[model samples]
Each structure stands twice: as C-alpha cells, then as structure tokens.
Target chain A: MTSQPEQGGGQAESLTRLTEQLSRLPGIGPRSAQRLAYHVIRAPKEETRELAEALLGVIETVRFCSICQNVTQTDPCPRCALPVEDQSIICVVEEPLDVVAIERSGAFKGRYHVLHGLLSPMDGVTPENLRIRELIERLRDDTVKEVIIATNPSMEGEVTAMYVQGLIAPLGVRVTRLARGLPSGSDLEFADAVTVARALEGRQEF
Target chain B: MSAIRVTKLSLTHFRNYAAQDFQPADGVTVLAGDNGQGKTNLLESLFILATGHSHRADTDREVIGWSAAREPIPYSRIAADVTAGDGRERVLELVMQLAPRGQAGEPTAVAERTIGPSGLRGGTLQKGYKVNGVRQRSASSVGDLAVVLAGPEEVDLFAGPPADRRRAIDSTALQTDAEYARELRRYERLVTQRNAALRDARERGSTQRTEDMRLWEQELIRAGALLLGHRITMIDVLQKEMLAAHTEFTGRTGHLALEYRSTVDIAGNGGASPDLQQSLADALEGAWGRDSATATTSVGPHRDDLRVVSGDVDLGVYGSRGQQRTAALALVIAQSAYIGQQLGDEPVILLDDPLSELDADRRERVLRHCLTPGRQVLITTADVELIPAEVRSHAAMYTVKNGRIEAA
Candidate 1:
C-alpha cells in the first residue's frame, strides 16, 4: 500500500523539499541534491545555520551597481567608483564574474559594464533581457571613447557583443573585441589544430 | 599488422543480434551466410564503432533489435577490443539508449546521425562513446579504430548524388584530422546560426544589414575555408592514391582522376594556404547577396563536389557499370592505403559482399589484394565457394544464421 511517510513526520517533508530545491541549483543533480540534503541533516546545527545565513546574506546585500550594472553591495560598484586614466574605454562583459576575471589580470585600467547575459534565440534569451540600455546610456557622454566587447567567444556571446556594438557604434564610440588564441604556457606541439590556427591568425608582432 | 584491428567485438540489442561477440582474424576473415543471417549486422556494429553511425540505417534506433522492446531497457551496445598501431590494446564502446523525446542536448555529429526528420516521433535514442572506460565525444574516438568499408552499395559513388561523394571524402577527412571533425561541426552550427539570424532579420522587416550578419559571415568563411582547404588537399592526395589502386585493380589507370571542383578558386593554392583562405573568403563574401535572398548559405564546401573523371567522360554521368564498380572498389582500397599512410595505422578493410558481382579472376585479385600481409580484411558473402581455396585456407571463417554467429 502506498502511504504518505511525511504525514507522520514533518522532517521527511522538509527533507524532500530541501532535496528538490538543491537539485534546482546548477551542477546539482537529483542524487547529489539528495546527498547534500542528507549531509545538511547530519551536520551540526551551527554549520547548517552558517550555510543558511550565507545564502541569505548574499540575497540580502547583493545589488546591481547603477553605473556599470555589476552585482555589488554599493550603488556604484568599487570598479565604478575608481577613477581611471581613460574615461573613454569601457570593457563590456556577459557576467559580473567576468569583471572579476579581468580585474585579476591587473590590466586594462578602465571602466566596466556587465550585460548580465548573452543573446541566445534558441534558449529564448534576447537583447532585451540584458542591460544594454544602461550600457548605451553610459556611452552617451562624449568622454567615452572605446567600448571593447569582452564577451566569451561563443555563438551567443558574439551575437550579444555585435548587438551591443551596433547600439554603441551609432553613438560615435569605437568598438573592439577581445583577441582569441591559444592559452599561455601551452606547448605548440600539444596544442589542437583549431587552437593553433587561431593563434596563427591572432599572431602579434614580436 | 593492420594499424588497428578489432580483436573482439561484442554487440547487444543491435539489429538481429541479441547478444554476440566476434573475434576477427589478424590477416583476413570471411563471414559466409545466407541472406538475412546477420552477416552485415556484425560488420555494421564495427562500422558504427569506427565512424559513430550506421552506413545504411537512416536512424540510429533502427539499429536497436526489433525484439529489444522485450528487454527491461531498450538499448544497443557495441564494444570492441582493438589492437592499436603500436600493438597496444584498448577498449572502445558505444551505447545507444532510449530517452524521452524533447531532451535538448549538445549538438554532435553522432547525435545528428541518429536523429532524422521523422526521428522526432520521439523514439528514444541517446548515443554515447567511451574509450578505455572514460567517456568522450565520438569525434575524439573515431580514428581509434580506423576502418575502410567497401561494399556493393559503395560502387554507386560516381552514379550517386554529389552528397554521397562529398560524404566519402568528409568521412576520410573526419578520421585523418580530428580538427576537421571539430571544424565540420562548428561550420554546420555556424550555417544554422547564420540562417537563423537571417530569418530573424527578415521577420523583423529589416532591409539594412547589421554587424551581426558581418560577424556570422566572417566566422562562416573562416571555418568554411578550413573545410574547403582540407578537402581540396585530401582530394588531390586521394586522386593519386586511387589512381595507383585503380591501376592495380583493373590494369587501367591513365584516365582515372578525382578532381575537386569548388565554388572558390583553388587553382593556385595548395592545402590550407593563405591564398586558399583568401579565395574562400572572397567567394563567401560575393555569395552573401544570394544567401540573403535565399536566407541560406549558397556557396562553400557544402556545395563542392569530388568529380571522378575517366579521361573525357564524367564517370558520374556516363560510366559503364563494370567501370564504376571497379573504380568504387579502387576508391575503398585507396582509402585504406591513405589512412595507413597518414595515420601509420593500417585500417581494417570491411568488404560487405563486395565480391558478389566480380568475376572469379577479379575476386581472386581483390581477395589477394585485401588479404595482403599485415592487413586486416573482413569480407562477408552468401556464396562461400566464390572465395578461392588459397584465400580461405588462411582466413578465419565464420557462419551466421538467424542473427547468431559461430566460428566455422
């Protein structure tokens, strides 16, 4: 006979709900989600409380910066607050994490604009979903010179970058894209043919 | 020894084969059985293992045994233990499981092969490739067991549509250069993406082109140039290879030629030269007008053809049946030699009833040629006596009946 086990114990219902919610997260499958739920149930009460607090902490404090549209706790993200040598150059990216990637390189001391997503018609993603209007509004100033499209070299990423370029090009700002080639420290012999071809095409002056 | 000979092949829920394990000979093996006895099914499982798709099955699920529904889970598995070029042995496996329709997944050449137009009826077909227990894309494992298949149907290469000829060369390219497979998949996706972009623009009633169009065009050309360049270089090499084999096959070789005719001007450029890329770029740019009107790409390697010309006669148009058949056989032989020369691994030659139409003398010639020292040849036939005694003397013979295979 099929009986509701959760009827006798509310904890079973809570465990089921927790597994479902965890499974919805990226990279967490049903089995992993169930394992994670069980792990949470087994861990000490204080550790589980810390994880819950951390989750709430991010949602409560995280906000998009009004200027660059990157997730931040402040109205203007730290990157936007900083003064750079070039007000004209702004690197456009698909996500806030990309901003972190660029900052880690310690190069390109300029402004940044996060699009939040790429243009993917197949997945129903479109230009309207991204923060393109904010990017264009930032480019309205005559001081802005170049908008380098730093989206990933993927199909949807290219479409988003090109769409943004179309909007900014009319504002008289120069448009550019990140160079794609083989990664640094990779041996040429071991490099794939496609990567080698890209490196050859993007060869820089020695 | 053949570069990579399959020492053992195990199949389950595949075609008429409910469960079967085959051990091919090191030199030449013959499978003799009546029609509908699952002779070709064994070879087909090996073909799918080598190339990731059935040579004849329009859909991948067609390979699943009809009685497969009786099983708890309807699936087909083909696994092989191959002796690689260096005499090192490894396991390669492919599994096709039934999955619910409407599962959107990564676009792979193998997946594309499985799903046809009517395939959307939701027949569950999720195919995968595994190498040495670690899963990988079929493209990565294709050349692991390089095989050159010569069958009766293949004799129609010249008479068949240009698509068939293009596919023959593409198959060879896909096996020889793994990058070609990646580029091929990218090019296919680019074409679809480009067409979708064009359709979106048309729906929006836009007359002015956008930077996205230029971007797609640029990427398309870059990928297309590589495909065209590789095909041209390969066709040139195959022309000479096929010629030598043709000469040896029929003692007639002067007029046999594999001319790669392309929309791009490849007259001067050899291989994937800068000149060749420039030629493709110019061609695509020029065809953009026609493409915009058609909402599809009109020029590229997709439209190119590999023409087999016998002197002044175009074999596809006007070749005798015998000439076409011999040439097709030569093409397969040349392909095997080419794969061996390029990858330093002699490909296992699969001849599916190839000697059915040939005379005694020619069959002897083909048998002598295919069963040469160190080469692995697997040929199937209904008439066992057609095989010369000297040939059968050393061959590992097998008999198939009602989907069951047994050593002869």
Candidate 2:
C-alpha cells in the first residue's frame, strides 16, 4: 500500500510544479491557476490534448528578431523582417511604448529598436544595463540615416542618449536627440499621445 | 582670521517674527528657543542671505504669513550686516510681500522689493553672486563663506535608505567641489536608462539578446563603480569620525563600525577594476534569467544598504534608545567635521532641543566634547537648565515666546 502511495505522489508533484509555473506568468495568480487547472480538467478530452499541443507549438516556434530583439513567432519580427521601406532612418526609443508613440505619430516611416531603460546609477542601472549593443549594431550599417533618439527628456534619458551617441560617432551615422519641449523627468508612457507624436516630428541631431 | 561675520541682523514681518534683531558675538552664538518658536526660520534667513537658496524646499508662499480675517497681507524681510575677509562691511536686505489668495488664483504683494547699501530691485538674487551693489557671475568671488546644518532631518542619514545618505553626502560634497556633483548627475542619468532597458527585455521576453544587455552592463559598471567608490571613501572617513564622536557622547566602550553593504557582489572590486567589471558582467548575465521572470532590477548597487553597527548588533535593532540618539548625534558631528576639514571652517552647529532625548549624564558629555573651540554653534531649547553653564556664559543668548524674539 505504501509503495502504491509513493507512485501516486510522483504524479501529484509534477502537476503541482506545472501549476506553479503557469501562475508565475504576468497577470496570472493562484486563483487563475485553479481556474485554468479546472478548465484543463473539465474540457473535452481531445480539446485538452489540443491545448497542450498548442502550448508546445509556441515553445518550439517563437524566436527573437535578430535585428531588433523583438519577440516573434517567426524570424525578424514582422516590422524588422519587411524590406527596404527606408533603410537610412532608425528611431531609438526607451520601450515599446515609445515605438508605439512614434508609429502613432504617422511621421518617420523608418525602423525602430527599443532600449528598455535610462541610466540610473543610484538604482544600479548603467549603459551596459540597457540594449545599447544592438543600437550600435544598427549604426554599423552606413545606409542607416538619422537615428532619432526618442528617450524621454529625463536625466537618465539624456545620459543614455549621449552615451549611445558617443559610442556610434565613429560609425559616421547622424545621431540625434529628441527635441526638449516634451516635459522633463516624465515616463514616455504618461505623455499625451499628441505630445509624443510632435516630439518625434521635431527631433534634432546631437 | 574668519573671512565673514554677521555682526548685526534684524527681521521685520519675517516668518513668525513681528520684529527682531541680534548683535552676534565672536565665534559661537547659540540661539535658544523651543519648537514652533521660529528659531530655525531665523537661521534660515541668515542662510538665505549667505546663499541665495532657502534650505527649506517649500515654495515662497509658505515663507509668508497666512491670515483668514481679510487682514492686511504680511511682509517677510531680513536685514544683515556682514564683515568681509577684506575688512569691508556690507548691509544686505531681502524683502517679499505676501497676500491672501482670493477665490481666484491671483495674489497681491504688500511690499515692494528692496536691498542695499542703496535700494535696488531684485539685485540681491542675481544669477550667481552679488557685489558691492552690483551682480557678479561667480560665488567664488563671495569668498570661502559656507554653512553646515545638522538638524532633525540629518537623522535620515542613518534611518533612511542609501539614496538619502547619498544625496546628503553628495550635497555637502557639491558645496566644496562642484565637479563631483556634475559627475554624480551624469552617472545618475545613465542608471535610469540602463534600468529601463532591463525592464524592456523582461517585458519583451528576450533574454537571448545578450549583446544588448552586455552593452548596458558595461556602462552601468563604469558609472556605478565611480559612484560606489566616492560613496565608500566618504563613508570610511565618516565612520572613523562618527565613532569617535559617538564614544565621547555616550561614554560607551563598545566598538562602532560603518559598512557599505552593496547588493552587487563587488567586494574586492574597489569600484573600477577589470576583475570587478568582469564580475559585474557575469552577475548581469546570471540576473538576466531573473530579470525576465520579474520585470524589475534584482541586483546592483541601487539595492545597496549602508549599515551602522556596534559589535555584532545592528544599531537599528538591539541598540538602546540612548545609543540611537548618540549615534544620530555622532553622524551629524561627523558630517560637520568632514565639511570643516574640507572647507577649512567648522560648520555652524544648530541643535534644535536635541538634548530632550538624552539623560543628564550623556547631555553633559555631549556639550563638553561635541562643542569644540573655533566653531560657530547655535542651540535652541526651552529648558535653560540643560545647557551647560560654560556654554551659557560664553554664548549669545536669545529667548523666543509667542513668535517674538528678545535678547536674554
């Protein structure tokens, strides 16, 4: 009887581990896990099997765009994978929000790469703490025209923009700072959509 | 010989004062008063005259009096006579009018601007430094005049986080050396960008982008190490001085130590070194997995904590109440000593009834050792008995009651 109980315990432990892993994803909590677990339990047996197959499909298929580092189900996320719309221009921004900000402006039909954060040394963030390598990589291509640095006009933002500008100056591509009229020390996410669009329109070279 | 002295000072319609004047003696002048009796306000005005900035960060409106009865608006003015290093006497005045806000946002001034030897409009607040009735672009010309204040807020040095201590240390360091502050500002900006980038990597679910992460890590290590080095050096000096002060005040034989506990494991790095850089790089790579798991920075000096300890016990924990007060006092005295050593003049010590927390034995020891010669000290207290007889005899005394200051 004890040997049989041990056999059942191994299966229960594996199930618990999976539940914990699922709950760890953003916006998923323990209660959500219970709901999801029940969904798996009560679904049509074939459909439940299909859901596991789909999960495995994504795990096997998704990869980062080699150029922009954006996640995609295919190589070179759709935006970066597309050809020669305008190879000369690149917009550098802090996050995907900034990418959205510039895209929504309907100006600068160029490409974009996101640097996640600004330099905040007190909080132990430095230039190496950001995605500046890929940015420098973008600079290596001579046809890449103006790199509009769309970092927020914060101290950290300005420092990052300056650091990146300094690193790529030898590459001879035009490095530019986003115009200052945008309010200082504010996150790009909070800026009114119109302000974000205009800032992009009026970017100036560093 | 001291370069500057405030010989006679007066205020009319100034914060909490209807009218007041004082003829400061040579060296130490202790201003005694209770809380809400306008002692700090009085000192603040003197500081404003010396440096254009108000130590109090509140807006100008709070500096003025507020009345609800549709009464006449109040006026805030400070007049001081200063003797320069060259033996020249100059009279400077600052005046601002206050008006009660109406239902609308408009405000009216009760008085116009005035400053002198001769009246001039807003001349006192020129861009950099004021001259003999002229404006100059350099505070360097204002000579080596400086003040160090140790009020209740400095308690944040120990009780508050590293950022608080960093700011406090940096502010004092800035006053003596402007270049250090500039480097700090540049370094701080870099950290923000680096952290934001790390956050984006997590949100985007791309840990394979090691090149991008590596770029930020390099810059972060460079800037972070510089700041860490400066802070560590400052803390080392501060620790030695503070421990001595703590012993004198508390008469305790226990050992006191200051530790800069960095979150990043750069123990032997000493800030800028190839090995340290590599260690940080390796740490960043390791932390990448965790950063993606939780879209927040998990490692680095930003999460650093500076600890003050007596033997094995953390001061914040097992230390007695008396030990805590003495530690607080020691920290301020240490800061003051650092400023004094750096600038060649002891900071003017302002004690706002700090003795209220101390027993008689400890209070006496504090007065004897902490109040060194050749330093300007101002202590405010309602209980006159707590003040040592030696201090009372040599000190310039003032009494404050009902917002009125009178010579004692």
TM-score of chain A, predicted model 2, versus the true chain A, to 2 decimals: 0.64
Question: What RMSD, rounded to one decimal, does every model reach?
Answer: 7.8, 17.5
Q: Flag regions of model 2 displaced more than 4 Å.
A: A1-206, B1-24, B42-146, B153-164, B187-222, B269-302, B401-404
Docking class of 2: incorrect
lDDT of 2 by residue, A36-126 (tens): 7667777899998898899898889986567776556877788987885788888888877777778888887888887777766456565
lDDT of 1 by residue, A1-206 (tens): 11212321555777888988986775444545667898998999999999999999999999999999999998888778888877878999999899989989989888999988887544445566789989888877788888899999876787677788878877898999999887888676655555677788989997
State the C-alpha lDDT per candidate: 0.77, 0.63
**Judged by DockQ cut-offs, is candidate 1 incorrect, acceptable, medium or high?**
incorrect
**TM-scores of the candidates, chain A only:** 0.88, 0.64
- Which run of 10 residues does model 2 chain A get worst, by summed lDDT? A1-10
Tell me what fraction of the real C-alpha contacts between chains A and B each candidate also makes.
0.08, 0.04
User: Which structure among the candidates has the greatest TM-score?
Assistant: 1
